[model samples]
Target: MAYVFLAVAIVSEVLATVSLKLSEGFSRLGPSVLVCVGYAVAFVMLSQALVRGLGVSLAYGTWSAAGVALVALIGAGFLGERLSGIQIGGIVLVIGGVLALELGAEHGP
Candidate 1:
């Protein structure tokens, strides 16, 4: 299903972004390779989702919003990073906006 592909794309992108941080400016070999491979697979999956009739706006909004939120959480929880209250609020807003987009699409005229 299109949604399945989109979910894969989102998770792949999130992992790739986290791998990017772990790559240490590409100085580390394993994570660096993961970064490249993850992103490549992410793009391919995203294209499959689009080709399967997932709307561009909805797909991209969900993908980007989820990616940002997941990456931030991973950074904070595992990478010793901190997020200010405002940043947390921003993440909530981004996710909310994506939800709005999806709901709007579902109930469109």
Candidate 2:
């Protein structure tokens, strides 16, 4: 389903972004390779979802919002990064905005 592909796209993009930090300015081989491969797979899955009738804005917005949330959680839990209430609220707003965009978009152009 397109939803599955979209989910994969989101998760891969998030993983790719996090791995980017671990890539150490492109000096690290393993994480750099992971960054490249994960992004490539993400884009491919996104393209598949687009072909399956999801709007690009909707798909990308949701993907980006969810990616931020997941990355934040991963950072806090695994990397010992800290998050303030404001940051959490902002992330929540991003998610709500994505949902609004999807629900409000015109079905036909």
Candidate 3:
């Protein structure tokens, strides 16, 4: 299903981003390799979702919003990164915008 592909894409993207941080400017071998592979998987799954009839706006919006939120949370929780109140609010707005896009699509033009 398109949704399944999208979900995989989101997760893969998040993992890739996290691996990117852990890669230390590509100085680290394992995480660096993971970064490359994860992003490859993410994009492949995203394209598959698009090919399966997911609208571009909806799919990209969801993918980007989810990736941003998840990466932020993971960074804060596991990577000793901090999130200001403003940044958290921004993430909420991004997610809300994606939800609106999805709902608006369902209602048609």
Candidate 4:
């Protein structure tokens, strides 16, 4: 499953992004290392998903949108970041767009 790999890629990417914030401009050793390693895993898994026949448009759209939403949520929940109502709406739009992409892909030629 390419979907499985995609999920891994999404999770790894989210983790890497969160770790980047924790890394404090790469001044912190542990989270900095995690940021580097997590991104590596994310890219490798994403490449595997692409190689396994996932369309580039669909895969990248879904991956990037989902990562953005997840990172925003994590930041708000754990990092005391404030999300305005407009930002929340934007996240909803991103998710809706990803779902539309998936649905369209299923009906695509």
Candidate 5:
């Protein structure tokens, strides 16, 4: 399904971004390779989703919002990153906005 491809795209993008952080400015070989491969796979999957009839606006908005939220959680939980209350609120807003976008798309012509 298109949604499945979208999910893969989102998760791949998130992993790519996290791997980029772990890549140490590209000095690390393993994570650097992962970053490159992950992003490539993500874009391909995203393209597949688009080709499968997911609206561009809805798909991109949801993908990016979910990626941001998931990356923030991973950063805070495993990467020793600090998240302020404002950042947390922003994440919640991003999620709410994505939900609103999905709901609107569902009800729209």
Candidate 6:
């Protein structure tokens, strides 16, 4: 379904972004390939989700916010990037807001 594609888009994008770090500024081969393929897959799936039935605001907002949080986590936990307490709180708020929107989403149009 559209939601399935949306989920795929999010996961692929997160993987691609994380691989970006491992790509070493695109100097490496394996991670570089992953970055390219993952981004391609992500956009493709996002388009498919739109065509299928998802709302534009719902899908786009969730995708953008989730991608940011996932990327931050990957950098902080895996890449040793520092995450301040305030930033962590903001991330949690973003996630909660997204979930609330999804759960209480309006359907008309």
By lDDT, the better pick of 1 and 3 is 3
Compared with the true structure, the alpha-carbon lDDT of candidate 6 equals: 0.90
Residue pairs with backbone overlap in model 4 = none
lDDT of 4 by residue, 43-75 (tens): 999999999999888889889999999999999
Could you say which candidate leads in TM-score? 3
TM-score of each: 0.94, 0.91, 0.96, 0.94, 0.93, 0.85
Which regions in candidate 2 have their CA more than 4 angstroms from the true location? 106-109
CA shift at 13, candidate 2, in angstroms? Answer: 0.7
lDDT (10s digit) by residue, model 1, range 1-109? 9999999999999989999998999999999998999999899999999999998998899899989999999999999999999999999999999999889888996
- Write one digit per residue (lDDT tens) for candidate 6, span 43-103: 9999999999887778887898899898998899889999999999999998888777777
Model 4 residue runs over 4 Å out of place are none
Candidate 2 structure quality by residue, lDDT tens digits, 31-99 = 999899999999999999999988899888978898999999998888789999999999999999998
Q: Write the per-residue lDDT of candidate 5 for residues 1-109, one digit (tens) a residue.
A: 9999999999999999999999999999999999999999999999999999998988899899999999999999999999999999999998899888889878986
Candidate 1: where are CA atoms >4 Å away?
Answer: none
Q: Report the C-alpha displacement of residue 28, candidate 4, in angstroms.
A: 0.3
- lDDT-wise, the better of 2 and 4 is 4
Highest lDDT scorer: 3
Model 3: per-residue Cα lDDT over 1-109, one tens digit each: 9999999999999999999999999999999999999999999999999999999999999999999999999999999999999999999999999999999989999
TM-score of 3: 0.96
lDDT of 6 at 75: 90
Task: In angstroms, give how far residue 82 of model 5 lies from its true place.
Answer: 0.8
Worst 10 residues of 2 by lDDT: 100-109
Model 5 misplaced regions, further than 4 Å:
none
For TM-score, candidate 2 versus 5, the one ahead is 5
